[model samples]
Target: MAKVIMVQGTMSNAGKSLIAAGLCRIFKQDGCRTAPFKSQNMALNSFITTEGLEMGRAQVMQAEAAGIAPMVCMNPILLKPTNHTGSQVIVNGEVLGNMSAREYFAYKKQLIPDIKRAFRKLEEYADIIVIEGAGSPAEINLKENDIVNMGLAEMVDAPVLLVGDIDRGGVFAQLLGTLMLLEDSERERVKGLIINKFRGDKSILDPGVKMLYEKGNVPVVGVVPYMELALEDEDSLTERFDQKEEGLIDIAVIHYPRISNFTDFNVFEQMPEVTVRYVTSISELHHPDMIFLPGSKNTMGDLKWMRQNGLEAVIKRMAEDIPVFGICGGYQMSGYEISDPYQVEEGGKIRGMELLPVVTVLQSEKKRCQTKGKIGMLKGCFHELFECEYQGYEIHMGQTSYMLNNSVQNVCENVISENGKNVYGSYVHGLFDHGNIAYRIVKILAEKKGIRIKDGVFEDYQVFKEKQYDKLADTLRRYLDMEEIYGMLREAHLE
Candidate 1:
């Protein structure tokens, strides 16, 4: 059996996923075949593999870190929230069904065998497997049925490295509190603790580390310095995003209550001059060059939310001047009105921004697959920019009916837009990843703002990320006690 070591965190967004990726890269660089595994992930951001299978983007980034092709099995189970109380479950990259939080908890255990099978397959080819645990294992109530944290550790009998963000302060408390909350067996699984995202002098933390070791009865393996790694974040509250200011384009994205696929803008953020900001208040809408309405799991509810926040009126006012782009739920919101007969979100016809003379009807069937189509001549202010064909895909639930030819037209049957500036919507996410498509839009926006863009303005996002992973791997190699980590993994395999 291949050596397996899990990276569990003291809390959510504790840098567990990033640490896992760095470890995977380090192992691969050491001439060992490595892969990343996460028992389960719950997030709105997702990616479609080359096989047309859906998976969390974090696993994909980790795969890239390991110099391996991404696979659906890497993330066998994914839960995308459709609303606060309910989520759409995806097993093996296929839509299982929608389940409420309570229902999911009751049924999640039965999927353990599937997770084990996927892990076994990965182990067969990999010399090492870096598993990531979701949230925290210290949740007393969830520990019983926990397949993602301690339960997964016990299932695979894998040694774990508990990671805590030292920069957040209370690092000792977070680590100690987690250890205190875990059962005896769960605590035994933790081989060491890593103080991650540390800043300032390491010697200053020596006393704190000494105290931690004395009290927690676990070795302080290493104090990892705060490294700015440009990788895709696993969840909404990404620390990387929190640190950076908006880029150049002055993009104001409407913050929906049930936003899904906001990760679609990850590609746009690659441009040095593009600024992507999420705004909830109407005052923040300002004079953005472009307004993007992102996908929402709940269309009618988000539409209702827009009206409640006076965003419906604000969006209409902005549409008249600048270009408005919508995707999925945002695309549904671009029509004249949206009607949900099935009571998907409070059940009824809701008034839309009425920018485009179109209507969208919510349906039961959800589109949960990969798409690829060429971008043609999209009629809009961006036409001169996106004149050439590009490629992308679509994922949405509502069906749109356009009232006029000018109201909506498909460019190469992929990109969608209304007469010039009023409305632009598409099901395609990650459309800006393609450099040509990205540069064209930036060029137009720059011209509109009386600015000029130099050549190679939009860097290739994948290449940029690979460079980031390389730097991250180097950082991990320097700071982390790799020998100690390898020894723990070997012990797990022997067991």
Candidate 2:
């Protein structure tokens, strides 16, 4: 069995996920077989495994840091929010059903057995397991049925490392207030305290750090510096959405209220000559070289929202001048019509953006699989990418029909398309994961603007990500007390 250590944050987006991933990388570098576990996760950013099973993207990122293949066992229960009050619950990579917040709160305790079974499966092969907790353990009302935080820590006999985000302010209050709220036993379970995302001098924070130690009665373990690393985020709270910068090649992604898999465009953000901005309104949509309609959890509702806010009309006008691209739900919305006979989304028929010669039907059955082939079937803006080999995954519930008589290229085995030879859409995610596809896209955009780029065109996305994981591990080793952490793991082994 693997020795377990749990990381619990003071609140959501307190950098718990990255901290856990850093530990995973550290363990892997030290030659330990490490894995990450999160009993429950609620996020729109998700991935499909080789088994065609769905799991949260954060665990997949952590699995990458550990240098291992991602498994469904790493994340057993995933809750994807379809709206403000309800989510579609998935267990062991399969959909259980949708439930309201109140309904799920009352029913979550019943899933304890499934969580345990998944943890045991990870234990069979892993030498060390780093578990991540959701939201905050101090959410007092939900503590009774809390299978993700202190409850799971107790169940697995794991000591907790409580993390407070210094960047969000009130570092002392955030740490001490949370300790006061926990039950005595739960408070005792917290073995160390970490202050994350510190941007300034250590001398200035020392007095407060001592105060936190005295008040919370836990040893201060680390003060991780704020890192500018390219990593996948779990939810919409990511700061990437707030960036409004524009570069030589401007690419705007439509930021729907329920956007899923926005990670699809993260690669572009890393390029110095390109800017990928998430636009929510007409003001943010200014004259981009390309427009991307991203995946959404509620496609019909988001499309309606765009219609009401007048973004839909503006995008249609812009599509005549700029190239427009979409994926999955976005692809469905770009078509001529959509009907939800199976009620997969909001029931009823609706007119689409009509950018492409295709129609979609929302189906109850979701199609998911990994795919790889040459990019030999596109037109217009993607003409430069002909025969460029690509690898990615497809995941969606809508069945699209190409209106063949309407000048369609039916590009790339129907995984991507060229309509009117100007508009494009694809059902695949991670299209830029492995090659110069991103480079070619930028080159196409730059050519349109009559500009020249001098950077090298080839990019191995996996190799780039591996360098980032190493950077994370190196940062943690310098600031964090890893010898103390190793001691805690040794204690777990002795127990």
The number of the candidate with the highest lDDT is: 2
Given candidate 1, what's the lDDT at residue 223? 88
| Clashes (candidate 2) | 0
Positional deviation of 112 in candidate 1, in angstroms?
1.5
Write one digit per residue (lDDT tens) for candidate 1, span 364-422: 76555556546656676777644454444456666777766556532234566776565
> In model 2, which regions exceed 4 Å deviation?
405-415, 419-421, 455-458, 490-495
Q: TM-score for each prediction?
A: 0.92, 0.96
Per-candidate count of clashing residue pairs (backbone under 3 Å): 10, 0
| Poorest stretch of ten by lDDT in candidate 1 | 239-248
Candidate 1 local Cα displacement, residue 70, angstroms: 2.4
